[model samples]
Target: VFCMKGDYSFERIVSSDVDCINLKDPVPLLYLKDHPGLSYNDSSYSYGESLSEFLRKKDVGNYSCYINANSPLIIRKCPYDPYKHHGDDNGKVMKNCRDNGYYHESRDGACYLCRLEGKCGCEHYGFETFINPQKTNETGRVSACGSDHVIFSDDIYSGVEVIYNSENGLNEILYLDPHGHKVKYGMSGF
Candidate 1:
């Protein structure tokens, strides 16, 4: 696929791919802005370094199967800052995933790790592990009324809006971010 190198905007009113009718014999996968800066990589038009196409699935179907506890991915700016997943420290940042996933804000060096799955596969994994009130509040106020604990993920871009695509159950899935841009990733595990 070919990629657009620099920041650019279309000057002419190229409504559809038909505008480039006189440029080449046959049109490629998508339309091009008719610029010299465009380069031929896989003979396809790309957006940026990582973007191969601009919202490839323009005619995508209905979206469903929403993610839980991860909305508007809240970034953990500092250690002292509160509002972690479970509404408290989860020990995810302090307890290295490479070492052990167990650690909590209430107690240091605790062995209990929140095993709830993480969401994004990006550099920072934003995920949460639900807590059981019966286990956490055996004696305190939790014993009066039942409630669930929610953990927060660092670098949460937004509540992950994943649409289940009927195409091929793979990477073609689209994630909608109400606050930011949507991203595509593999659905191998999901």
Candidate 2:
């Protein structure tokens, strides 16, 4: 069973459809058992609990049951951020997840899809610490997770300015070329 980001609050029971099987206490199903002769692989540091075991908790997060993929079955819940998701604090922002709830590192500005529990790609960007986006209203500045700068759409090619160098951690002003692509003005052209 593929438990989504907020599925930890409910009980998920799996049972075989064959006759005489008790439905009250259905056995936690395994994907491997359903597909005979298929190899079962787990690559996570912690060999996590079974689906039935994971379904017992009430934490608000995401988890999975023996996916054929190499990723680990880890449970995670995104923390409440009034500025990141929306104005309210009623946990309704979970709907924004997998929709537009992603932002980049504060220093690099490279976009990441999922930030489980708000842990963005800081480590991947070579930053030892996660730097939250600064809240700004400047026309050309990027305030990724800020109240007015939440990345609502995936269209990245339009209305972009100022860029941060991931390697040097320096900000650079961008100028749109005649072709409409953003480029750093230097010896090349205006």
TM-score of each: 0.15, 0.16
In terms of TM-score, how similar is model 1 to the real structure? 0.15
Please give the TM-score that candidate 2 achieves against the real structure: 0.16
| RMSD in Å for all candidates | 23.3, 20.9
Residues 91-151, model 1: lDDT tens digits: 3332221122121222211111221222212233222211111111111111100001111
Model 1 segments more than 4 A misplaced: 1-156, 179-190
lDDT values, one for every candidate: 0.21, 0.24
- Scanning candidate 1 in windows of ten residues, the lowest lDDT window is 139-148
